[model samples]
Target: MKLAPLHAAKAAIESMSGDQVLHTVDGHAFIPMDDVWVVATPSGPASFNFNNLPGASPELRQQIKDVCRALLVSAAPSRASQALTAYRVLIRFLAEEMPGRAVEMISLRDVLRYGASLKAKELYKLRRLKEHLLLWVDLGIGGLDDDLLIRLPDLETKHHEVGAAVRTLDPETGPLTDMEYENLLSAIRNAFTEGKLTTSNYTLLMLAITLGARPLQLAMLKCGDFTVSARQDNSKIFILQVTRIKQGKGIRPRTIFRPRELAPALGTLIQQQCDEAREWAVAHDVAPEVAPIFLSDRSSINMGDIGLRGHHSGKSMAEKLRRLLKDLAVTSHRTGRKLHLFQSRIRRTLGTRAAAEGHSASVIADLLDHSWIDSSLIYVETRPAMMERIDKALALQLAPVAQAFAGTLVMRQDTDRGRIIHTATRSQLESVGTCGKHDYCRLAAPLACYTCTFFNPWLDAPHESLLDSLLQEREILANTADLRIAAVNDLTILAVADLVRKCGEMVGRATK
Candidate 1:
């Protein structure tokens, strides 16, 4: 099809079923050709040979030329600006890359080959750009419904490598050794003392560590969102009302209480940074609009070089975090202890520490802004080795009681004394302070159970039942197919049963 005639191109596009064909550009339907004008580069003017060219208006074409020139100048003339240079290179490539046998056709295989040559992270980015360009083809330039025509070679292996490359690009977490943890603390303290990090970043880092917040969410934090006040008794408390989150219901803000550990450091950090920014703004005589709370000191340090004072953006804040880790030589505390510089690593560390400390999983999930509880559970899930240790400890503590009632115990006891028996059991339990009825118990005099009489019968009954229950539970547990959880439970249950039996015998003999 030699490009459809100008009037025919417009008619073909306009005639397409439904709103799918919004307009036509060149010979492509659904393209808003009139919205833009192409300034033919001398390198490849033949790219514009579509019959329905809709001829560019002189003024619009001039504007496009001006835009192209301005972009070229601003991008600088260096190897570092290759991507910017590629904007022009790509325009030229498109002329020839387009399928010669078909109008408005581009070689997806070549695009994929070109994309594959770039790094995995870069390839993902280009794919997004490709998607954007397709959108523009549909909306910006009136174009035919040719989305299905665009194709790329299969990337079966590339799909798997993409994930690995993402991890390489940014490792979210690894263990943190004691020294590294302390070093992070030290850097933060020094930054605060020297006014090197602003209060916003300090509070933000603390909040990020405490709540596992993202950079965008941190950037969006407003001063009014902080609720600093005192209780009826005048005790001070500061609450951060997180108004926006990424993972949960859209716009469903969740508030996380500031940990007591961070309360002392937070207010001072915020005020120190805010005060410094205000002072800097006044000193430089710069407009306040650009000075956000997290602006860096680099611009303040070199205010004389630029016409307008430099200010920080969200991108700069992320870069600053990378710089901090680089300066500190911070590494993931794993095998080889490889250095990590990504902001996601920082968030993960915060979450991992919280999980290790026994905070509620739901709270951790909220802090991390995880959409699923299972994702948050990963932080606290005990590994097989750790679970084995827990099993050993539980068994060791319950051994004696289980041994005493090894055979004579019953799994269920009818101690109904109408007392809501509730399946009484006397497993070797960890001491959690006096039972709720401790003060009122008539058997407070408890040196020898036989002599006291109050501690023997009831204790032995429950003790026997507990041992029997544990043994039965262990027997059932042994049938578990998985080696980790079931094995641990089996060993732990058997140990507890033995301890219960031992405790039962001890009480029975005391009574005898």
Candidate 2:
């Protein structure tokens, strides 16, 4: 028998009520089919004018079209026919589901229950539909409901089981252990020291890690952006000119003092790059500014038989960085073969250090260029159990505790509360070599802060930055003072001790 026309079949089902759907076109009206067939179908073309729908908006229509497109792209001819049947089913269901209910009156609970009854993956698909509805609200689809969306239960398993499974993967995503951190850093440094990377790349990596620079920020650094000056004691201070800093909000600062070690390294990198560029310029008669700090070498430049200068701009530095990382056996989150040995290692280190230094969340947010302090808080995820203990112990304060153990330590008199708690400028700890405590003094040992009797100079940085003082004040106020020491037995000492241990642990992880 000849099949009925599709439009004729649809027209026949026009009179069907809320409980009945036009399953097949057979003339001017439609015929009802098995409920199971309706359940198996998913979508269809509208029988009535789509624009005539009671509350459809431009965005809602767009969403419907998108879903239709996705379905059409994946659907077979038979599946498409079945989907048409399902659309009819949905219309019938909606009619009976909420009679006379305006679009705004539809609640999340109703939508969720309807969705939850589907298969697991289908349930997720329905959730996507709900999200589309949310977008519709933004696009002014009727007067939308203001109630909060109820979270759907995970259809696959219980919450406890899911959490346990997640915890199993935590070691990879969570902060690295000290040894792992140190190994990663060492590997990256070795790549530089062994001459695997050019001077510019080496300098960039160091600055990026040490100063917590993002990839884009590191890429934008220029030759003139840094300065190194020699001190009278034959020491050098590196002053970094971070013109394109992410946190600077596009405005360059006049100058900022970087760590003392950066000066010489930067000088070497800059001079090498400049000297090479100068030699090249003399040979080719090119301008000095033409030599970008990170320009690709002519040999590596893919010319496709064309001259290197023609396609030189296309060589991506980020891609080169990724290749360098592979050479160093580093796993990267970035797409280009960029070295990630220090990306995670350095951020975790800085985050842990800044948090331990008693820097406020806002300060960290600024340093990290986080849009919110809440985002920065994610980095301060070390030693949770210890922090809880410290919080409780701090209730007793440190004055009485310090007085009780006075003679146990050096009992140095200092007016500066910071000096009592940490090393400051013009203080004994700030000096390089005055402590005659040991041949291998704890303070002088690399990555060994626990055995040190003196307050670590690094710890005193925040205090000096705050007070703007040169000398550590000398005053003894037993009534109110918390002494700095690296002992586990004392609570006040435990705080700093915790930091030292954590720092050591971080170093250990990088090394591993």
Candidate 3:
């Protein structure tokens, strides 16, 4: 049969409806098996068309569609898409060896020849083909021969796993170096403080940095998922119930989730974003209870399609995030270039940092939400990049946190009364240093003063107390929140640590 032309096919396309599948895109629908389906995937709605397989006979396409449509009911949403890829390869093989033959006509010899036709790089993809063939045969007699299904070669994929392990050690593609990680956190804080990063985007980056979660998991976040509890002192402990992805066959995000306690700083940022997202979602007629927190702002979106929208682009959150980081233009110390900020890199960094802190594989696996221990092995095996103290691993740079001892060291605790400046921190207003510049300034108060050349710090100020507080916060956040959050104050900690030493020497010398 001569297939329909593209222009004719465009106009002749038919639509179908299923509880899950929205429609079809078949130009030549020989059987009613739905050759092409536009289905709602976990991330968003997607189209999977089998019309590319024109070489596939009507019987073979029917068998393949039967297997895939059945899978749509029980398998993960990605399975249908993968089946398209695997079957397309089979269709390509058929065009060469057996033109337009039905499913049951293919034998063991034919299947072996198909396998041999694949290139080395394409071998892993064939694994899915063999599985698809078996599933096809199980559907009916109009499939590959039973002998081929029984005697199919099992792929030895240990080499693939080992290759993945080696890639995890790469600085550019895998785990970041200790200094590079530090710079990343510093840049995040700096960008946020400067208002270059928005509140929602800040929360997005914080989640990615801390949890190392995939983009789909992040996209699945809902407003109500963020819950709050209290500690003994009534400090609010925020818990984010993150959705799980890539769990296994047939598992959906809503079926499984893991709760993680967020750091106070991040909790504050996400709380602001939650209020904004929830307000927007509710005003748009979506049920408040089920409103998504990670929403997009595209004008073309219908009120009904807002559910599970990825980001501003109506595309994957991965692309949205990559664009956000690229827009922020976070520069790396290693290459002096804009950091790409890949999610996989964040995950590897998170894993390696956990391993460097003496956490076992079980702990690393739990932190990364890995389904198997083998996936977490690379972190344990390759931790040489992270040798810094746990608290300093991914330190966020302070706004003024960037420098140490830039201010004048005065001999006496007494200062020119008018020169002294007061700032509030931890709910208390205290005088830290005197400002040398009297003109109006918009920089963050005490932090900016520490590195200002015109500022003068007194010997009797509570520098030790501030240093202690910084260290304590960093230590707590590292364990409860994440290494990145704990280390956010690292530069400021170093700055304070330097000041304390300088003050001590100045005081001791004056007394002598």
In terms of lDDT, the best-performing candidate is 3
Q: For residues 1-512, what per-residue lDDT tens digits would candidate 1 score against the true structure?
A: 11223234334444554324231111222222433322211011112222222233334333332322222222111211232233333334444444342223234553555566567555554554353333223222332224423432122233222223222323234434322443355455445545766555566566655555565455434333444577799966765554344442112222332222237457556545455656666776754433334554553322222222344333455666667555644333233343664567666666666665677668777776666676666666631122222233355454442221112222224232221112333554421111222233343221111111112223333434444454455445546543233443343344334545455566688789
Model 3 CA lDDT for position 470:
71
Ranking the candidates on lDDT from highest down gives 3, 1, 2
Flag the better candidate by TM-score, 2 or 3: 3
- List residue ranges in candidate 3 displaced over 4 A: 1-34, 97-106, 119-121, 153-159, 162-168, 299-315, 385-512
**Candidate 2: lDDT of 176?**
38
TM-score (all chains, Cα) for each model: 0.42, 0.36, 0.69
Residue 259 lDDT in candidate 1: 29
RMSD per candidate (Å) reads 18.7, 19.5, 9.9
**Candidate 2, run of 10 with poorest lDDT:** 35-44
Q: List the candidate 1 regions with Cα displacement exceeding 4 Å.
A: 1-134, 137-140, 143-179, 186-208, 216-225, 241-262, 275-291, 297-311, 329-339, 354-365, 370-512
The C-alpha lDDT values of all candidates are 0.40, 0.38, 0.62
| Candidate 3 deviation (Cα RMSD) | 9.9
Give candidate 1's error at residue 79 in angstroms: 25
User: What lDDT tens digits, residue by residue, belong to model 2 across residues 204-312?
Assistant: 5655566665543444343445456779998877654543232322122223422224557556766676566556655766555433344445423222211222112
The TM-score of candidate 2 is 0.36
Please write out the lDDT profile of model 3 over residues 1-512, one tens digit for every residue: 11122223222323333322322221111233555566655555555676776577677666566555545544454666676677776667767665555444456776567767777776665566766665555444355666765676453321223426334465356677655575566566656656778777787888888988887777767777888789899999999998776786545666688999889988887788778777776687655546666676652233234345423322467787777766755445445566667787788888887887779889988898999888887777775532235232222232123333456777445556446666566878777777766654676667656645566777777876777777777677766875655655555565566677777778788899
